[model samples]
Target: MINQIYRLVSPGRFEITYRDMSLNGNKLVVRPKYLSVCAADQRYYQGRREASILQKKLPMALIHEGIGEVVFDPTNEFEIGQAVVMVPNTPTESDEVVEENYLPSSNFRSSGYDGFTQDYVFLNRDRVVPLFTELNNHTASFLELVSVSIHAIRRFKEKTHKRKETLGIWGDGNLGYITALLLRKMYPESTIVVFGKNDYKLDYFTFVDKKVLINDIPQDLNIDHAFECVGGRGSESAVDQIINCINPMGSVSLLGVSEEPIEVNTRLVLEKGLTLFGSSRSGTVDFQDAVNFLQQNKEVIDYLSQLVTNVIDVYSIKDIDSAFEEDLVSSWGKTVMEWKI
Candidate 1:
């Protein structure tokens, strides 16, 4: 089988090799159906700190947010024509012992093994998630990211959150828009507000009923809950906006992963008695819930696909380099690769 392996990190790009590998053991062969690129892939492609660490310590397959069809399944969990979503994290055989709230062992799939970017690749049976027919391969490819956004929204609702509370989002990126859409379903009556700088990018979020420029975000606005979706440097401003705007005892969820350490208004959080929490990937429970949500709310998801602006063929993987360059400069919604088998 041929696979795209991320070998090393360099100044301009990630060194990748398309090479052949043996398919032995209980490894199930999956044919790539569709793959979506997240901000994490961009950071890794750019040789960022986290991606560099993973590249050094382990062999990671490039794309994590993807869906595939089982081409060769010796395992009983998968059938020849089944479509499934993959959870990227799982425990490796060499993994050091660690407790986890999501999985029984550690989180380790995409990091330890080859991912779903090639024509066909081997994967463990346990990592595959069977997607329903309601979600086509293209839309199902985003199940992982949708699970992340759903988990973050659920985390925000654990407190004594009011139904009419005004929720504010700090970023207008893909994850930010998804979080907003999920919250709309969870709290139909609540007023949701989105904040970002780019008007062109913001135009893609027409699905979000309320939006505002970052500058227009009122310093004293009555914010009930805030989600920080923009990671990397300068994200502190978003956190500060949440701290300044949130009401006393309101909650803030840090869904963004910052590359640099950001300073938060600790005084404001402490003085106002704000509740803060950090959200990562979805747990197994959350994953099941997200699948159910998508199944139950198919109409909503069809509408949500409008947020997807670009879909390129995987045969044109060469175009990915240019797409990444353009995406770095300016991108509105999701960019995906359609696989033809």
Candidate 2:
């Protein structure tokens, strides 16, 4: 069958491309249901990336965060019409020491290869996790991002010491919100504090124990561990602040994606004997963990549902363009596309 893929051929432009897919193939075929736009997609849509990087990765399908329905499953591992969250990381080779996301050989969708902005997304059997029937479609659309926070938190648990008295999260964006929410539930006894530059943006984090303005933080304020979700230029100072405010021997989990290299206070890090680890894309296990986390704690869906600010229905290439355009202006919440196109 011929599949129609909506690709961004250039900045602020989208073109549809056609390709043939085999129904008899080993892969499971899915029809995208709801797709979510994120910061990375915004960077590409607005031509914010470096010229060389853009030149190398143009004309690629754009959304990686999405939930789809199984249209065909040759192996019968999944029933037809099953709702599933599509995993974007594809790992060809597995390692004993390195996780699939950290593996150098892995290929992630929407980075260089085609993503889910196609008529149908062909995926490995392991790449799609079945969603609970109670999950909201719009909330499940961004499950990929939720899985990322799950992956990062898992790493934090493994690397950080057991002194879970207080936890600090910097950045009041979507990622910071999700990470803070997960940490709050996972460590009920620990205090959760969120720090951000804008008070209005920080207002969304009412569930956290405390909200601190980044500049007005008390000198006596200290966190046992910190998660830095502030990416881009803000990361430099965020890391510095985390190093300053975090307790000795505290672990720092870096989940932000910096466009350029940021300077870290190695002197302070050495003096404090702090351990810092960075987490990127997630694997199937993380996706499963994320799905299970949401299923077990149904109340989290209420908190997460607030993150969906815009839901646009798509029926054509023009609608796809509109979705990206509107997502660019959305301030605090995620923009979801109802994938009718």
Candidate 3:
């Protein structure tokens, strides 16, 4: 099998090589079906992270979201041909996993071991969740991220003040769309508003309850809750918008990973008695809920496939850079790589 390592601090080229791993003990071999390139992957790929933190986490493979089919297994929990989603992070019960109420476990898979960009990957069967018969490979592949969005909305529901408070979303990317869609399902009577930079993304904005451009946020619009999905240098401005748009005592869920530190109005936060949460990956309970939801709603699987824009072959590992560069600006959804035998 071949694997590519992302050597931090360096840019321009990838370190691709081959390796052999026998399924000794409980290890199983997964045939890589899809590996999604997330925004974070690009940040790490471009060497735009902090240098000290980079040194501490150096010499790691650069994939976090991936899905594959079982090719070989020692554990009977998964079948040879069963499709599965890879839960990147391995969390321990004792660890303080939450950051501002979100789980930030450091044991993500791809960063430590050889990632899912290989023809075949060796992993413990426990690290995977078998995709049900209803969902196809493409839909199954996105379960990891969708699960997080589902979990975030559920968290918001727990702290909700009203049965149907006006909701606002700060980004219209895949996570924002998924979060809005799930929020609609959870709160049928709620008015969900989506805000984003792109106007064309709003063309297919029927998934969410309502859509608006960043500039169109009505001055009178005081959302009861908001979610931030765009995390970069400008993410702080989005956070400001969310804080300003939400009514007094309204909550904001911070789900984005910003390369730059976010700035917020502390005085307003205190004056409004606001709640701010950092939501990340799904917990064990939420993970199960996501799988169950997918199993029950086959129609959503079809809709999710539309969000996938590019599916490249991992055989062209050398082309990973180009694959990401093309989709860097215009990509509305996900770009994944398929490893063929």
Clashing pairs in 3: none
Model 2 ranges with Cα > 4 A deviation: none
User: Candidate 3 on 239-317: residue-level lDDT in tens?
Assistant: 9888888888888898988766767998899989899987777644565678888787766677777778877665554
How many times do residue backbones clash in model 2?
0
When summed lDDT is taken over every stretch of 10 residues in candidate 2, the lowest stretch is 324-333
Per-model TM values vs. the true structure:
0.84, 0.99, 0.88
Q: Which ten residues in a row have the lowest lDDT in candidate 1?
A: 93-102
lDDT of 1: 0.71
Model 3 has an lDDT value of 0.71
Q: What lDDT score is found at residue 249 in candidate 1?
A: 83
Candidate 3, position 175, lDDT: 86
Q: Where in model 1 is the C-alpha error above 4 Å?
A: 1-27, 50-59, 92-113, 159-164, 207-209, 316-323
Candidate 2 residue lDDT tens string, 1-341 = 99999999999999999998888879999999999998999899999999999999998999889999999999888899999999999999989999999888899899888999999999988899999999999999999999999999999989989998999999999999999999989999999999999899888887899999999999999999999999999999999999999999999999999999999999999999999999998999999999999999999999999999999999999998899889888888899999998
Error of 1 at 248 (Å): 0.5
Per TM-score, the best of the predicted structures is 2
Tens-place lDDT digits, model 1, residues 1-341? 67665432342343567787676668777777788877776665666656557556444556778888788876566789788777676544432332233444554434444555566766667667778887766677777888898877776766646644688888888788788888877777788888888787687666566788888865556877788998777488889878888888888889888878899899999999988888887645566788899888887787568656677764544555654565565557777777652
